[model samples]
Structures are given as C-alpha cells and as structure tokens.
Target: MAGVVTGDDVRITRKVQQLGSSTLAVTLPAEWAREHEVEKGDSVVVQRDESSGSLLVVPDRTLVEDAETTVDASGLDADALGRAVVAQYVLGRRLVHVVDDGPIAPAHRDAVLDAERGLMGVGIVEETTEAMTLRCSIAADDFELPTLLGRLDRTETTMRDDALAAFLDGDAERARAVEQRHAQVDKLFYLLLRVLFATYRNPDLNRAVGVDTGFPLIGYRSVAQDVVLMADAATDLAALTGEPIPATAREHLTGLEDAIDDAADAARNAVVDPSYADVTRAREALDRARNRTDAANESLERERPEPLLRLQRAVCALSGDTRHVRDTLDVATRLTFRDGSGATPE
Candidate 1:
C-alpha cells in the first residue's frame, strides 16, 4: 500500500526499495494517504517490471468514475502537428514521430530532413514509410514554447513586409534595411533554439515529456529558415537593377504575392477555425501558385536575353517565400488545435 509522510506539510517520497524476493518495492508515506482521504479499502494501481524487479503504485485510476482527461491527437493536421512536435521538444520528448497515413511527398520530406539538421538533436528516422518519425532529445515548456513560435512568426512577417515594401517603393535603403533585419531575426532564432535545448537538458521537463516533441521543434526551425530565405530572396528582387520590372513580370510577381497572402490567410482560418475546408483550399491555391511560378520560370528561360530573365530569376527566388509562407500557415494551424479546438475549437 502507498502512503505519505508529513513534515511542515504532507509530503511523498518517490523511490525504489529492495525486497528479498529479488524485487524492489517502494512504500507509500502514511501521512500522504491520510491527507488524500485514502483508506485501507481503497484500490491502487501497481505497475510491475519483470526486468528490473520493480513496482510502481498509485491511486487506482480505474476507481474514478468521471476523471478529467485531455485527448491527445493521435492524428494531426499540419498546424497541430507542428505545435505537438514543438511541445514535445519543450517538454523534452526526444523521440518524436510524425507519421502520415500515406507516403509523404518528396518536397515535404526534404523540408523535414532539412529541419533535422537545423534543430538540436533532431533527425529523420524513416522517410520512405507511410509514417515518418523524427527524433530529438529536447525539452519544451509552456513559458518559452509560445515565445519560440512567436519569434518565428515575427521573423516571417518582418521579412515579408520589408521586402514587399522595398519592391513597391523602389528604395535601395529599404532593401538594405530588410537585409539588416535578418540579423536580428537570426539572433532571436538562435536564442530560442538555445532555450529549447537547455530545457532538454533539464531533468524535470525532460522526464515529463520525452523525445517525441522534437519533430515539431525541428519543423518549426525549418519553417523559420524557409521564411528567412524567402524574405532574403524577395529583398534581392527588390534591389535588382533592371529596366522597371516588365509589365508581364510585374503582373506575375504581383499575382504570386497575392497568392502568398491568400495562402497565409487561408492558414489563419484553419488555425482559428480549423475547418478542413480552409486547409484544403489553401493547399490547392499553394499548389497552383507553385505550378504557375514554375511555368513562368520555364517561359522566361526560353525567352532569355530578351525581356524576362532578370525578372524571372527574381520572381523564381520569391517562390521560396511562398513555400515558407505555406509552412507558417501550417504552424499556425497546429497551434489553433492545441488551444482546445476540437476541429477548430475557437
């Protein structure tokens, strides 16, 4: 039977004790059971280990008729998936698995692989299978977890706003400013990573969550890198010294920009409302934009030294921005589910 001991306050000691039967036993402190209103007749759950000859006892969970329990999403959407992985890292869940029902796309898989290198103690275990597992030994917590996500969001926003403004205003100074801002974002990203890894090393949080959360952490880092790269490319386009962007190129760039914005907006709905409809629509739009950009790039290559090469290179680079934007939406979508939205909770 488990019991508690009292000092200045009722307390419990969790440990292992040796038994003569080649086993280890832990006694519950008497004061604890009394304080908890536990009686001799009350049932308790005891977990036994044959390998180590150990036993773990607790108040019998089965005895409770209506216990409050939170449901874990065994299956996750993009947004929810990212947050879970991040939470796992913050909680020090090191061995994270992001398994899908079908085979993942090569691009998506590559993105995850890149994330593994960018994040601490993160790596891809099985990329070719129906479900992929990412492993990382990191700790995540409520306090700093949101902050890390927030910093990444801010980085994307800053880059997009700066680059877009520079392009519109035709200002070299603005382009330089946008580039300079990257340094700040980079610094914050590093700091967030440091905090995440530091939490992983802490015994308490690490023990609580385990390694499963690393996939999300790595995923988030990957998104941040994508955003940074996208923004940098956009800023470069804005700084390009070409004949005022051609009418066709300008129109195409504008369309791509609008599509990127739409994708981000669609993701917002998924994050806030979590309807599959919204995610589906966003995915479709993103796919179309990617295809259009590819076609535009090909056409430009064929018409080179004539009119579109300069614009094409600049615009193609901006495709990276769109992809990162999509990932950001995915991140946001993951967060909405965590806030207690069943299908898009609030």
Candidate 2:
C-alpha cells in the first residue's frame, strides 16, 4: 500500500500487523473508508502506477455510478451558465443538473442547449420548467487519446488546406467554413481534457485511453492545445485573405504554407507512431519551416509590398504560431528514446 501524503508533507501512516500465517495487513483509515462509502463487505479497487510506484484505492461503487453535479443557475448570465456546465463536464461529470429555483429563463435555456451542442457525447435527456439534465455518454474506454488527437490533427489539417485554398481563390464562403470547423477542434480538445483528468484520478484508465499515465498523458494535453492554437492561426489567415494579394507576397506565402503543412504533418504523425525516424523527421520538418519563414520575411522586407505588415505576420504564423507544434515533439522523442519501436498500448 502507498502512503497517503497531504499538504505540508504530512503522511497518514498505519502500522502493519500479522494477520495469519505468512500474511500481514494495514488497517484502512476509518474516515477515508466512511467518506468513500466503503462498508465492511464492499469491494474497493486498488490500482498501481508502474511509473511512479504508487497505489490508489477507490471504492468500486463509485466507478460504476455516474458522476453527477448540480449547477445552481442563480445569478449567472447565459454565458456563465454555459461555461459552468462545460466546467462540470470537463471535470468528468457524466450528468449535470442545471437547476433554477423557479422556471428557467429562455436565454439561459438556450445557452444550455448551445453548450450541449458544442460538447461531444453530451445531450439533454430531461427538461422541465425548473431544471434540466444533461448527460454525457462518453465512456472512459470508448475512445483513446491518441486516436482522438490524431482525428484533431487531421481535421485541422483539412481546415488549413481549405483555408489556404479559399485564400488563393478569394472565396469568402470557404473561409467561413474553415472558421466554423474550429468548433470541431474545441469539442475534441474538451473531450480529451475530460479523459486525461479521469485517467489521472484512476491510472487504470491509462490502458483504456491508450496512453501512458505520466508524461504521455500530460504530453497529449500539450499537443491538443497546440493543435487548437494552430487552428486559431489558420482561421486568422483565412480571415485576412479577402484583400487582394501582392504577387511577390503570394509566392512567399505559398512557400510558407507548404512548409507548415509538412512540419505539422510530420509532428502530429510522430506523436501517434513515435519512432526515432519519425521524431527526427518532425524535428527536421520544423527546422525547414523555420528557415522557410526566415527566407520569406527577408524577401518581404526587400520588396516592401502593400499590406506588408499583415503579410509579414501571416508569413510568421505559418512557422511561428503553427510551429508551436515543435514544442510537443519531445513527447514522441522520449517515447522513441527507449526503443525505436515506440510505446505499445497497454
């Protein structure tokens, strides 16, 4: 059994005593047992983290029960109410009760509906005058983090491509479509956050989520955030494309776009497969993206084209903003460090 350590480095310890022949046992803390609703005959699950050599005990009962939270929609406005529901969802709450003492206002009800629509696997099952119930059907074992992250990667890739195509053709409709897909990235991001939080609480979920409990889990979160940031950059680029492009800037911008595509692709793929070759490719791709951006910046400076600042910023984001992906390459790099074979799913 692992010792429970709390604030100020205080550990709750128990003395071990002989129970029977070749058997020894430690007594559970009465308070902890009671708080967990652990009765004499109830089963408790003990999970061990191989990386940290720590054991966690949880009541089996809680695992099977859906976690529910009550959100008092009292003084909160529509936006705040929506955010509150999202917060509860991200915290791994499967059921959220949006309750008001009296009849729910139309604006507040609409906000709740919007929030549900934005979230993955979340739906409204019950609605009444005073309260509404939102249920999240996301099971811990249903989708793995790597799989979900890969989906996000691909979705953003398509979005970036569409945005670029829309920009080159001066198609506002396509650009608007790209902007709308950012919501898809957000849904994946929040769902990943929820799974990560759950796995941290119960290391047993690491296998279910197809990620290691330690750095890989944290690294997945980091990479997901980077993908979201890249989407923002891509969307910003799309919005700017409505104006006429200078011929000189166009060539450099196109080069930067290709460079971004290569770098982002390699990096995201490495995260999924995590081989030494893949990691190296990711690193080299990012380096090339940087060099491409620098060359474009120099060219723009020499030409002094119209909308120079905006063009320059756009050029920079292709490498500067999107290349934030490089920061997460360490995840794949480390995984490949032990063996070029990469981490196998538990």
Candidate 3:
C-alpha cells in the first residue's frame, strides 16, 4: 500500500486493485469525493506525470485567492516604510497596501515608489492621497530557481569583468557603467529571494520553483548571496579606477583577477549541476585564487614604507569581498553527493 497525496498531517493509504483485464483502479474516499462534488458517473481529469510516475486527479477547477496584507504607515519614516514593503514581498504577499490615517507624508510616498521599482514583478496598481497599493503579479512557476541563478551568475560575471577592466585600464566611463549595472544584480537577487522564501513556506511549490524543498533550496540561497558579494567586490574595484593606483598594486592584483574569473565561473556551474568532476575543477580554481590573493596581500607588507599605502585599503577590501566565492565550494561538495536526487516530486 502507498499513501495517497493530500494536505499536510494527513495520509490516506490505498492498495491498487484490478478493474478488468487491462485496467486498474483505486477507490476514492467518500468524504473526499463528496467534498469535491464528484459522483460515480463524474469524469475527473487525470494527469499523468512522467517523471514521478504519479497521477493527479482534478474534479473541478478551484480558484485560489491571492494572499494580501495591509501595512499601516502612519508614523513610519521613509526607510521604515521601504523595509516594510520589501518584507511583505519576501513573505509572498501578492497585494500590499501602504495606508495611513490621513494623507501619507511625501517622503513615505517616495519610499513606496522606490521600493516598487526595486522589487521584481511588483508595481503600483492604484494610488490615492491616503493609500497606495502594490500588486505582485508573479507566480510560483514564473521563474525557476536554476534559471534565475544562471541569470544572476552571467550578470555578475559580466559586471565583474567590466569593472576589472576599468580598474586596470583607468577607464572612468566604464567604471561608472559597472557601478550602475550593479542594480540589475540586486533585482535578480531579490527575485530569487522571493521565490526561495515562498517555496520554503509552501513545500508543495518545490516542482514549480524547480528546486527541491530541503538541501537544493538552501544551496541556491547560499550561492546567490555569494554571487552578490562578488558583484560588490567588483564594484569596489571599479571605484578604484581613478584612485592613485600604484604600479606594484596593479601588477600584484592581476594574477588574483585571472584566478577569480575562472574560479567563479567554474564554481557557479558546479553549484547548478554538481558532480565529482565539476567539484574537483572548482576546488582547483578556488585554490589558485586563494594562493594568489594571499600573495597579493603579502606584497603590500613587504613593500617599502609607503609603496602600496595609497592602494592598500582598496586592494584589501576588494580581495576580502571577492573571497566569498570560496564559500560556494562547500555547497558544491555537498550537492555532488545528492546524486541528482530530489530534483522532482515523488
């Protein structure tokens, strides 16, 4: 006997039986059947899932209401209101209202506008003097975690590469562009957060989000944060473009940059599709990056009294920020042992 699928904390076990020479059937619970308005002659829709070898029965279409909440922004400041809006979005709220007893302050209104622009798939549907409504039109199946993670990886890689080029080439315009492009990565990160958090709250959405409920979901969250940290480090490198960069500093950092370029790409791939071979490749590249960063840092201490003084702080900050890429190796190692299991519902 196998347990039938239903809501949490309840299980209905059933045994398969023969109907006719070439047919099989299982009796549905009378209580469940009556609740769904299904009768003996009713034709319930049956969907067969090839991957899990499971059949889904739908007696009728049920309309699910969107989840919503109302936030009273009476005395909250701009920063407070902004945080509130983001909090609701991450909690899977589909509709949010920022209301006050009377007309909301100008600063609070601007804060809501900024929050809406920052979040993905969230827009203002209606606005009045006293209240503003934000509507999130995204679904669980809208974007898979793997695909979203890939997009983040690509964007961060491009930004880092451009920022590094601007740093080493002393290109001011390109540096500005790199800094500006950082926002896109943040947007992707937030969207990923929404999906991951929502999926966590509703384990049934595992298939819809394209990541399993337990370990795979946690790994994606960690990897996404690491990528964002790398982007921040890259932006730091960009900011140093017009700084008084010493020749020795640039020469020392070049090796580290090269190592990270390979290490980050390899590590991201391994996290997304983990295997022994990919994990080994990522580990090797990360080792190279670590060694290079250590050497780069040591060079500053061994230099003359003020040789790297002007560039020491920027170099240290950039190196430390980018080192977060090393954390992804742990995730890759753990996932490699998962044997590609739990990728789909059972």
Candidate 4:
C-alpha cells in the first residue's frame, strides 16, 4: 500500500500487518476514505507519479463526463454573450446554455450563432426565446494534436501563398478568398487550443496524444499561436494593394517574401526535429531575413504609393513573425536538450 499525504502535509502512518502467509495490508484512514466516498470492496486505482515519486490512489468512480455550464446572459449585449460562450468552450465545457429569463434578443441570438461559427465542433443544437444551447460535437479522440498541428501548418502555408499570389496578380476575388480562409485557420487553432488545454489538465489525455515528454505543452501552444499569427500577417498583406504591384516594388517584395519563407521552413524543421544545429540554422536564417527586409524597405522610394508602403510594413511584420517562430523553436530546442547543469547543449 502507498502512503497518503494530505493537503496539510499531514502524513498518515500505518503499519504493514501480515494478513496471511502471502498477503500484507495497510488500513486506510476512515476520515479520508469517507471523504472520498470509498466503501468496502470498492475499486480504486493506484498509480505512481513518476515526476514526484508519489503513489496516487484515485477512486475509479471518477468517470470522465461531459461538462455543462449555463451563462445568464440576461441584458448582456451581443459581444458579451459571444465572449461568454467562447470562455465556456475554452474551459472544456461540452455544453453551454446561454439563457435569459426573458425573450432572447435577436442580437444576442446572433452573437451565439457567430461564436459557434468561429469555433470548431461547436454548434447551436437548439434555441428558443428564453435559451440557446451550444454543444461541442468534437470528441477528445476525434483528432490528435500532431495531426492538428500538421493541418494548421498546411493551411497557413496555403493562405500565405494565396495571399502573395493575389497581391502580385491584383486579383480582388482571390484576396477575398484568402481573407475567408483565415477563418478556417481560426477554426483549426481554436480546436487545437481546446485539445491542448485538455491535455494540459489531464495526464492520460496528454499521453494518449503522444506528446513528447521533453517538449513542453506551453511550447507547442506557442508554436500554434505563432502559426496563426503568420496567417494573420498574410491576410493583412493580401488586403493591401488591390492594384497590380509595380514591377520595381514587386522585385524588392519578392526577395523579402522568399527570405520569410526560408526562415519559416527553418523554424518548422527545428521544431519538428529539434536539435541545436537546426535551431542555430533557423536563427541565422531569421537574422538574414531581417537584414534583407531592412534593405528592401530602404530601396522603396519615399514618394511610393500608399499601398506599397503598406506592403513594406506587412513584409516587416512577416519578418517579425518568422523571428518569433524561430525564437519559439530555440526555446523548444533548449528544453529538449538541457544538460545536468541546466545549460543548453552547445
């Protein structure tokens, strides 16, 4: 039997008594057992916490259940109602009830619908004058973290490419499509956040998804956020310059674009296959990209069109985002290869 430590650090001492020739036993504290609603012959799970070297005695009756929360949205505006619903979803609530004692305002109902559209697996299953019910249809096992990350990466890459092409070709329709696709990126990101939060809270879920022991959850979350930010930067870039880019400015922008792409590739490699060498290469690439962006900005004439200025700023933002990604990979690499002295591997 394992020792139990209470929150007050009070250690419960028990003697190991021989029950028979082959059996030994330790009695549990009545108070503790009663608190957990343990009864005679009830099943319990005993597992060792590898990190803390503590034995955990968990009641097997603590079943994983779908959680529900009701938000009293009485008199709340549309934005507030939307934020409240999103908060519940992010908190891992499977079902959310947005209720008003009186008739639900049309604006408030629209807000709930908007929130559902923005999030993944969330939908309004039922709505009435007094209440609206939002359900998360996605199961924890529906998708794995690695697959989500891969999809996010691919989606963002496509968005970036399309945005660039739209800008260069002056395709207003394609630009609108790129903007619309950002919503898709947002969906994947929100879903990934939900999964990451769940895995962070439950070790079983973490292990089930095969998260690397050396890779911190926060690091993965940061990478996912960085990917989204890159997509946002692409969207911003695509929004500028509906007119065809001038040949002169386009040449400079293309160099900056290529540099950003190279830096992104290096950062992705460092994160997916972490090593000191990969991180170092990513850092170097980002540095070169930064210098190139500065040179490109200088090459643009001071009297250039407003759209070109916006494009220049967008390129700079993309460079900044790529640097952020490289920095995240740098931290991930250090965490994965820390020495006994806590120093990163050379």
Candidate 5:
C-alpha cells in the first residue's frame, strides 16, 4: 500500500494494485478528485478500455469541454470539393456535413462523394424525409498554409498587373475589365481571411500545417489593400484619358506613364525581394518619379497659358495617381522585409 498526504487537510490512501491473476486494485487519486471537482456523492462517466479491461471513470466536464463544429456542404459533394474542405479543416476543420434534400446538383454531389475516405471520411449518420446528413472526420495532414498563401498572392498579382496594364494602354474597355477582376480579388481576400480565422480557431490543425502564417497573412492583407487602391488609381487614370487630350497634355501624360513604369518596376522588384537595400533603392526611384511629375506639372503651368487652369488640374490628377503608385511600392517593400521596426502589419 502507498499513502500520499497534502498537509493535514488532505490525505490519500492507496491499496493493492492488480496486474494479472494475483492482481489487486486501489482507489482514485485525491488530487485528481479535487482538480475535477469530484466529491464522494458526485456521479462520473465510466468508459471501458477496448484492449485493456480497465474502467476509466472521468468527470463529465472533460467530455463537454471539447466543441465540435459542423461545416455544411450539402448536395454539392465532389472529390476535389471534399478534399478542399478536408484540407481546410485539417488546418483545423470543425464539424463538416453535406446534406441533400431537394434536387441537388450532380457536380456538387460528386464532389461530396469524392471527398470520402481521404483525411475526411464520408458517412451517413442520419436521414429524414427532407434531407440526409453525411458527416466527415477531419484529420491533420489536410492543409498546406504556405501553398494556399502562395496561390492567393499569385491571384492578387494577376489582378494588379491586369488593372495597371489596362490603364497604361489607355483602353477604356480594358480598364473596365479591371473592375470585374477587382471583385475576384475581393472574394479571394475574404476567403483567405476565413482560412486564417480557422487557423486561429484550431490549434491542432495549425501545428500539423507547420507554417508561420501570422506574418505572411499580414503581408498579404496589407499588399491586397494596397492593390485595391492601385485598382482605384487605374480607374481614375482611365477616366482622365476618356476624352482626346491636347497634344501638350498627351505628351505630359506619356511622360507620366514612363515615370509610372519605372516606379512600378522598382516596386515589384522590391516586393518580391523584400530586402532593406532593395526597398531603399526602390524608394529612391519613387522619389525621382515624384520629381519628374513635379517638373511636368511646372512645365504645363508655364508653357500652356490658354488652358493653364485645366492643364494644372489634369497634372494634379496624374500626380495623385503617381503618389498612390509610390505608396503601393512602399507597402510592398515593407511587407517583404522581416525587421520593419515601425512598419504597419500587412
């Protein structure tokens, strides 16, 4: 027999412990009793060990502590779709279910079936007159946070490039297309944020994914916000060029385009490289772009007296666009680097 004492107020007594044919058993630990709020009269749940013929009496609180969430993906089950959801949950999927009541789409149903037997299992748990429930088990190896982030970054880059190119080409139709792309960017950005929220909610999934997502997500968010601004600047530039500008104004616009190109190139490189030295160089180039815009604005003020007021206003608009371009580059550079002491997150 063994005995444990915690001062005079608490004392634990132990008896013989059984092993085999000549085995014996003892009472539960007193410390565990106090920790679990179990008293002499309090009830507990007894769970039998499958392999070891041992009974484990645990407090009810332990069972109720863990929460299981359900993700609804009814009638729209595909192999890829299931895999995607499983992957999402592994990064930390709560309770996910697929239900089909009325006429469900074939593709969706297929996706739901396809998701079965991977990390997530497809099982029919309940049925009703209206709908049937298919539940899936979420496992760890399902989500790759870095890969997802890369995909999102690529999508953002594509949209930004398309919008900037359309504005530079002076094609109103093409610039209009950028608006549609912006909607896509917005959707993607929202989806990524949801994934991040899941990461925070599910700790096991986060450990399994083994990614340092906090920083990258911040960077992507900041960059995405900047790109949205970039898209707006493109829209404004498109409006500025809708009418036939004067020959002098056109020349000035062309120079602004050249300045914008240089600044964009510098910013893109800085964003990709994300080094202090590279950002410093990009910042220098942007400063020069600002000087170019100022010079062009002053030239219009002096050389074109007849339309001086209108010319100045147009110059201001173009300069504002350039300023936005500069700011985007600055943000990209800040996000690229690790030790940005005073930089904003994302």
Candidate 6:
C-alpha cells in the first residue's frame, strides 16, 4: 500500500492492484475524483513534482487548452479591478475577462489599461462597454528565461549608466528619460516572474520553453528580482539629479557612480560567461563600490546642500544594489563551474 497525496494537503492510503500482466494501477480518492469530474474511462494526467517528489493527478482538460478566468467588476472599484487582473496574471492564467453588468466605469477601464503597461505580454485584445478581454501573449517557445534575463541585464545597465550621466552633468532631460525607462525594466521583471511561476507549476513548461538546465529555478528567479531592484535604485539616483549640487559633491559622486558601473559590468560578465575569475572580479568591484561610497560621504562638508545629502542616500542605495548583483554573480559562477567540470566541490 502506498499513501495517496490529496491536493496540496491531506493524505490517503491506497493499494496497488495488478492489472493483467504488466500494468499496475491505483484508485483515486472518491471525493477527489468526484470533485474533478473524473469517472471511468476519463483521462487524467499524472505528473511528477521533482522538487517534492510528489505525483500530481490533474484533469486532462485543464492542460489541453489555455485557462480562461473571468473577473466580475460589477461592484469593485478601479484599483481593485486592476489588482484582480494582476493576481490572475501572477497565477499563470492565460486570459482574463473582466465583465460588468453595465458600462464599465471610466476609472476601472483606465486601471485595466494601466495594468497592461505594468505587466509584460498582457494587453487588451477586445473591449466593449460592459466587458473587456485581456490576453497574455507570451508564448513559451518564443521567450526563454535566459533570453529574458539577458534583456533585463541590458536594460538595467543602461538605466544605471544614464542615471549616472544625468546626475554628474545635471541634465534634467536625461534624468526624466531615465525615469521613463524604469517602466520597461518593470515589464521585463514581471515577464520573468511569470515564466518562473509557470515553470514551477508545470515542469513541462520549462522543457517547452527550452530551459534545459540542471540549475535551480529559484536561483534564476532571485537574480531576475535583483536586476529589478538595481533598476529601481538607478531610477532613484536619477531622480536626485533634478536639483543643483555643489561642484565638490559632484566630484565625489563621480567616483561612486563609476564604481557602481564597474560592479554592473562585472556582474554582467559573470552571468553571461561565468568563470571563477569573473566572480573574483565582481567581488572586488563590490568592495570598490563600498569604499567609494565611504569616500563620497567623508568628502561632504558639514554644511551639505540638500542635493548633496540626496546624492549620499542614492550612493548608499546603489551600494546595496551592487551587493545584490554580486550575490547573483556568485550563484551563476558556481553553476557555470559545476556545469563545465561535471564535479561538485568538497
């Protein structure tokens, strides 16, 4: 007799029965089977969850087509409707239909449109007075995790560079543009998260998307999140540049910004072509960024202008982001090393 795993909780015991000569079978729990509309001659999918070593039995119909969810927006407000759509998106739904009894409120309609901007692959495909259909156009075969992550790295690094330039040159136009690019970073981050969650829920999705690797999914997901945080830090740095600062503070800021840029470059190299040497270089860059931050703070006079104080805060935030990048580089380097040698360290 082997135990039956019911849903994500509870367990039941069942005995394996010999079927003819070669097949062995077990009965599904009566309650579970009934709830899922399983009957004799019906098809069910049995998938093995590698992370937990559990067998998952799901209805075949659930997997054969894209899942469509409908959100009733009859009473909920604009923000609530937006959050509902986001929640469904995060849960890996392929399509969401928002419906109301009458014409949808202007605020709610605007909110739904805004959500499409914030999320990747989500867009309004069809809309009427009373209903709207939002579709997630991300095809598993088209956007692989590695490809999306590479895009994330590029976008974040560019944002960081532009932010630094804006701050050093006191260019308000460039600073505003830096802020605009944060939206793209956010979209990419959301897309990466959606792919990660899809892979976790259905391991087959990973293979379908060509993510053929032994590396842990959590590691990739963490690195994607870190990249998003780095982009946000760069946005913060750019925002500070709209105000005027003393020339002395700008001199210190230059060193701090350059150190952060070096750290970004090292991290990018470590992820793309990881080696022990690149890992070491990334670590050294982080150390350099910390030292530069300290130097920048020390160089400020007692009568610091508001802009200089803001710059100091941005430097501290940038230092924290560099540390996060260094941590991700450490994981990537180890994975690359292991894959290359086929050996685990003692």
Worst 10 residues of 2 by lDDT: 337-346
Residue-level lDDT of model 1, residues 1-346, one tens digit each, is 4444467653555578788979986655666566545687887655443235554455643122111112133455444545555455434444656555566555445545544544555666654455566765433443354455456556656666666656644666777777767665654565465454543333234233322233344444555565556656756765664344444445566666667766765664454345566776777778767876876677677755344555656676667766666776676556545444457422
RMSD of each: 17.3, 4.5, 7.3, 6.0, 14.5, 4.7
What are the lDDT figures for the candidates, one per model? 0.56, 0.79, 0.77, 0.73, 0.52, 0.75
Runs in model 4 deviating more than 4 A are 1-66, 212-215, 301-308, 338-346
On a 0 to 100 scale, what is the lDDT of residue 172 in model 4?
89
Model 3, 1-346: lDDT tens per residue? Answer: 4456677625676788998899988888766676667797877656443335566565544313347899999878899999999988877789999999999999999999999998889999999999999999987669999899999999988887788777666789998998998888988898898888776555556677777766777788899999898888878878877643556567657677677777777777877787676667766776776787787768777774343553565566556744677678778777776666434211
User: What digit string (tens of lDDT, one per residue) describes model 6 on residues 5-92?
Assistant: 7767477778889999999999888777777678999887676654466776676653423468999998898889988988878667
Better of 1 and 5 by lDDT: 1
- lDDT accuracy of residue 168 in candidate 4: 79
The TM-score measured for candidate 6 stands at 0.78
Task: Name the TM-score of candidate 3.
Answer: 0.76
Colliding residue pairs in candidate 2 = none
lDDT of 2 by residue, 1-346 (tens): 5667577544687778898899988878776776667889887767665457677777764354449989999899999999999988888998999999799999999999999999999999999999999999997778898889989988888888887777766789998999999999999989989888888776667677888766677678888888899888889878877666756567767776776777777767777777666676767777777777778888877878878776776775566654476766766666566444644421
Sort by lDDT, best first.
Answer: 2, 3, 6, 4, 1, 5
How big is the positional error of residue 200 in model 1, measured in Å on the Cα after superposition?
2.9
Residue 88 C-alpha lDDT in model 2: 86
lDDT of 4 by residue, 1-346 (tens): 5566667746777788998899987787777687777799997766554345666565654334447889998868889999898878877789999999899988998998899999998888888889999999875556777688778888888887788778878998988898999999888888887777665545455556646422455666778888898898888877873777766667666666676676666666555555556666666767777787777777755546556666676667556666667666665565446423344554
| TM-score quality measure for candidate 4 | 0.77
Q: Give the TM-score of candidate 5.
A: 0.46
Give the distance in Å from residue 25's predicted Cα in candidate 2 to where it truly belongs.
8.1
Poorest lDDT segment (10 consecutive residues) of candidate 5: 61-70
On residues 3-82, what C-alpha lDDT tens digit does candidate 5 reach at each position? Answer: 76567635555676777998676767776777667888776656443335545466643222222444444533455455
lDDT of 5 at 75: 32
Cα deviation in Å at residue 261, candidate 2? 2.1
Candidate 4 local Cα displacement, residue 115, angstroms? 1.3
